[model samples]
Target: MRTAIVGSVLLVAGAVAAVTGILPLSDLVELWDRVWPILLFVLAITVVTELAAAAGLFTVIAQHTARWGRGRAWTLWLLVALLATVSTIFLSLDTTAVLLTPVVVVLARHSGLDPLPFALTTVWLANTGSLLLPVSNLTNLLAQHAMGQPSPFEFAALMAAPAVVAIVVPLAVIFVLYRRSLLARYRTGEGVAVDDPVLFRWSAGVVAALVPLLVSGLPVWIPAVAAALVLGAVFLVRRRGVLRVGLLPWQLIVLASGLFLFIEALHAVGLGTVLAAVSGEGESPLALLRLAVTGMVGANAIDNLPAYLALEPSAESPLRLAALLIGVNAGPLITPWASLATLLWHQRLTSMGVEIRWGRYMLLGVVVAPLTVVLSTLALAAFA
Candidate 1:
């Protein structure tokens, strides 16, 4: 994973530089000038989640969730699903993918339940559940900046109903798909043993503060940077020895740089006109559907973040731009390479010795992503 991220960063940087004569400086400059706060918000959330994970916060929550299941697989499924959704919304889907996936897998295995449904629930929710907040998915931030929305809260106002639709559609579908397997519950033995109760509470408390911050209509970076700093200080006082530069997420920084550079190069070569051609510029249902389908397929083929960046310039209307992000954010379920969250979910499953067949995966995704996009787009259309 690290290798791929680094390699992509290097390749995009080298290729764009080779072609553009100075590494897409104009695009980078423009991106930094316009959207640097989004980058900081992304990085801060990454750091905050990583730090919280390091403090064993996610593990504690996972175990408690399993315990809350009380030996009922269905309840366990609901709780785990809720946890995954919450993690994706608050900590970012990357955290849900990288941290929450393994925890749920462990919980399922410990309870002698089939891990597939729980795992799928986590992975699917990681992408689909991220529509609620601007910081929930990087694409949300991109949508905010690229669409030039006047108020950050506008994303929530317009997307809240669609976010609900995005989450509920998959929840219903996946439950039916996994219901047979979820029968016959077993108790998760003693749940997880948390090491530091004080730090755990502190971590959870500070992290919870992010909710109010995000909805406060303040800048996206303010609450996140504040929360991350508080947690970093806690770690410094309690476990200062464990502090390392690794938590800074340099790879993500590089990835951001490469994405901007790549987009810059594309713009330089006039890809915007092509993207604009496909972007639905009207308020009609057909135009909205086109935007949703196109965004989903493009995201699955090329990854959502870059796909959003590539096509974002073409989205002129508020409703169209929001719909585009809905597709990219909620509809990346078809392929493993569709979203970073899905990719991270795949890596987590593979490490846990679970493999999902491509056919079955695509089959489910084909059903889920479209309905998610359609219902959510309709909701957005109504809201808009």
Candidate 2:
């Protein structure tokens, strides 16, 4: 619903800008043509992730996670963090935010465990863990393309170290914060029931195939679309009745495309020039730090997509651009309004019977998010 409103607003605003001769229709068309792959990749990867989840893949993983924890809270936490981080990096943060959060929530409760640590792990990782892949976050896709299209491997190469630092810092932070709560664990008897073992195996196999294919540096959409089709075929053969049209990530696709159009419109009136000024020819560590701080604050203030769009034009080089990306990916954790993933995670948690104190969430984020943004950007500045 919000995506529709935002898309509609962008359409109207862009139309007005074009009519007033502030922007050319040709420019708009060119902009859309340049970034259209965002929609395709988002849809294809989302489909693949959703289909695999529907095939009971996530549930099976969650159950196995419980078994592996051996009634140890810290062990369960490490596993949960790993799961959320993996889901975020591979499937995009939204998949982890929307799909994995619920699974972890239920797993925590079913295992008679405190849920806050698990829940926080999911949401935190959903934001910070998205740095490692082109497909990991829509922001990364936009940043990757905006900076000039790099291959999948090249994109990951730049982020590989920062991504590690991003996850590691948060792991240490969360461990400190929740160490006491994490000490209790409950036995998950046997395992969560898996409904069709063969279908599960097939769906899991297709998902596993995605890692190599994406890292192959081929176009992400092609491999993602192929995987979705393969898993989708298995689902249809066995679980045909469960497929819903809503499984298509139309909102996300529209969100990505609409954000582009809106940002381009902003560029038409000289806003982009102002933003581009921030990127000057400074490549010093301090310059990177300042730029990242700007991005981090922008994301918390107006959300990361627009924030990235605003900051992107100023990123004078790939290195500084990569630095800005660290802020964009890791810095959005400070508020509910910071990223759509945080919002979605909040909504999911509330709906599933967890009462999140907004005040407290923000307070904790204030303490941790800036720290995360600084550490992550520093890692990028040093290693990337």
Candidate 3:
């Protein structure tokens, strides 16, 4: 809680500094000019996705799997994670959190499993899965636009090997550690009970909202506009009472936009050029590896999106970009603050009274993240 407060304070202070000229508005304006469309697009998608989740799509999915106990719970959670990943591929990690976290919390309680693992899996895989598509994560989208890199399908194919390794290995580790509890829960026949018809209706509505986004290659704005209309109609039908369904995290949306503007200010001060120069002197695979490692470490210190924005312009090759992206996503596994998804997961866990200490989370990250990074980098270097 203290960490969240401090982080919030820092975010606000940074935004103030940027706006007041202490951080330089010229750079902020330059980036805003160039990236504002994408920013709006992301924000719109975030809003719409949140609304869809409020409609209870995850609850509906979880209910269908309630009969199988632990296996059912784990599988459902895994599917939720995958759905979050898919959502992130199109919307962004933030949107995935908005859409999935509430459902995950309910499902975790219903299944009698620790929410931490599910939360971690969602955030971690959301990062990895988003890497497979250009629209999946902010960093990937920026990289694609800035560099004219591979298409989403192309990138996903290239990342297929790493994605398998990442998901399978982590699940194995998680299962090994928690097998007893999982098995016990399975034997007990514990499962989620469907209590609310309203939730089911909402879930159906959310799925309806997402179909256009998924089936067609329509611009994000189309989905955004559709969601707004649908949500608005739902609101009018319920006479503003339905707003409680929680379609969006308005605070987070504002916070992300503000941070982006703040980082843009830093970028304008020639930080990109400085970093680019540092990156240009060497092409050693080890050096590239080190950069990726450092990026992960730095993401914990700062945040991943900002760190990516700062480092991305310096990336000289597709290989370097891949390393940086994989490293940044993997790095967040080590620290709660390393990725927005982690932070959101932490918040969700704490809200549910699930206690996972920072030390333990870091311990897991130290073990898993480096291995994932190395494997992902090798895949990228080989294929990209």
The per-model lDDT (C-alpha) reads 0.76, 0.78, 0.62
CA RMSD, predictions in order: 4.1, 3.7, 4.1
For residue 203, model 3's alpha carbon misses the true position, in angstroms, by 4.8
**Order of all candidates by TM-score, from best down to worst?**
2, 3, 1
Model 2: lDDT equals 0.78
Residue 86's lDDT within candidate 1 is: 87
Ten-residue region with minimum lDDT total, candidate 2: 251-260
Please give the TM-score that candidate 1 achieves against the real structure.
Answer: 0.77
Off by over 4 Å in 3: 1-26, 33-57, 68-92, 185-203, 214-222, 239-250, 273-283, 347-359
Deviation (Å) of 218 in candidate 1: 6.2
| lDDT (Cα, 0-100) at 97 in candidate 2 | 81
Query: How many clashes (backbone N, Cα, C below 3 Å) per candidate?
Result: 0, 1, 5
The true-versus-predicted C-alpha distance at residue 146 of model 3, in Å, is: 3.5
- Please report how far candidate 3 places residue 307 from its true position, in Å: 1.2
* TM-scores for every candidate against the unseen true structure: 0.77, 0.81, 0.78
lDDT of 3: 0.62
Tell me how far the alpha carbon of residue 289 in candidate 3 is from the true structure, in angstroms, after superposition. 0.8
